[model samples]
Target: MPGRSPRRSTPQPATCRTCWGGSDSGPAFDAYATAWEADAKTLTDALHELADKIRASKGAYGGSDGLVSTQAARVRVGDGTVSTMPAYAERPSALASY
Candidate 1:
């Protein structure tokens, strides 16, 4: 529909009714794994890169975050159902530790 809005993404798992167990936010997430000590920086950098990719792909899938969101509207009218638009991603209320 012409007035339909796009879906948004939530950064934290809390909105999904769950909690994230890992710390891949930046370089420190991988640092927790001792075995990856040597490649800690590399691993976190890759993680950051992966996060970027996730955001990039979303814009094409009806998402507004410019990442994991879809690039276009995924809902079709006259399907007898309404799309549950995703909420926009917002920064955490407080800084969290891993």
Candidate 2:
């Protein structure tokens, strides 16, 4: 995200003209830099939006997990014990084929 931040010192048309001795390519370089800066800003904005969505989703998932755990704890098996699922790592035999 930092790398995609808009450059503060983007080459101005005047600066490009000076660098190129007022050559015809100066305008072209200026146009290219302007377009690139605009694209970078767009990308930065999109990334920020994506980060916000991810944070919101994370909070939602945490709340859902807690609710599910509470519900699971309330259910009892035939032995009157709380039933729980095993983690994938605890079931290596189930992944033997993979």
Candidate 3:
């Protein structure tokens, strides 16, 4: 007995049921349900807010890309045979040496 550890008893289902007021329709169940619902709503609202931010960022990136493309289209570099000219103007070749 001096070298032996004390044994611990595990609670049965009845013991657990009794602790929660003995049935499903109890104060403990009601409190748990209310807290769960509140937590779910808070999570849903945060997700929606995050989605809106992502959409706005996507639109901003798209607009910036369009503006850059438009500006790039207006720039032109000359080939060795001619002086520099706008991209919209006619040139001997589409490629430039410098």
Candidate 4:
């Protein structure tokens, strides 16, 4: 035992049956469903906000004109520059495929 290393226990998987349609999933599923709805709402709200910002930027610059440049144009979003245009545009149905 002096030279032997201590054995580590196997880590348990962080999972809930109720959330993923397993046995005894009633209460767990309910709780997870509530949280899922809240998350979905938050994502939708954030996407809407981004869309509004893009629209405002379009008005300030010109529609599609500001996005296009002789050289590579980068749009600033917060502290970072996004090198693409359509990324800021809103497509509500885009997440529907998921």
- Best by TM-score, which number? 2
Relative to the unseen true structure, what is the C-alpha lDDT of residue 35 in candidate 4, on a scale of 0 to 100? 100
Count the clashes in each prediction. 17, 0, 0, 0
State the C-alpha lDDT per candidate. 0.61, 0.85, 0.82, 0.73
Is 1 or 2 the stronger prediction by lDDT? 2
lDDT of 1 by residue, 17-98 (tens): 3335444433345455655675787889999999999877765554445443454456456656666886569778655753
Candidate 4 regions off by >4 Å? 1-24, 63-98
> Residue 31 lDDT in model 4?
87
Weakest lDDT window of 10 consecutive positions for candidate 4: 10-19
Model 4 lDDT per residue over 3-87, tens place:
9999977543335453366555766767889999999999999999999999899787774564577334554466676566565
Q: State TM-scores per candidate.
A: 0.27, 0.57, 0.48, 0.41
- Which residue pairs collide, candidate 3? none
lDDT (C-alpha) at residue 60 in model 4? 78
What is the lDDT for 7 in model 4?
Answer: 98
TM-score of model 2 (CA atoms):
0.57
Q: After superposition, which runs of candidate 1 have C-alpha atoms over 4 Å from their true positions?
A: 1-38, 63-98
Shift in Å, residue 8, candidate 4: 49
Against the correct fold, how does model 1 do in TM-score?
Answer: 0.27
Worst 10 residues of 1 by lDDT: 14-23
Error of 3 at 16 (Å): 14
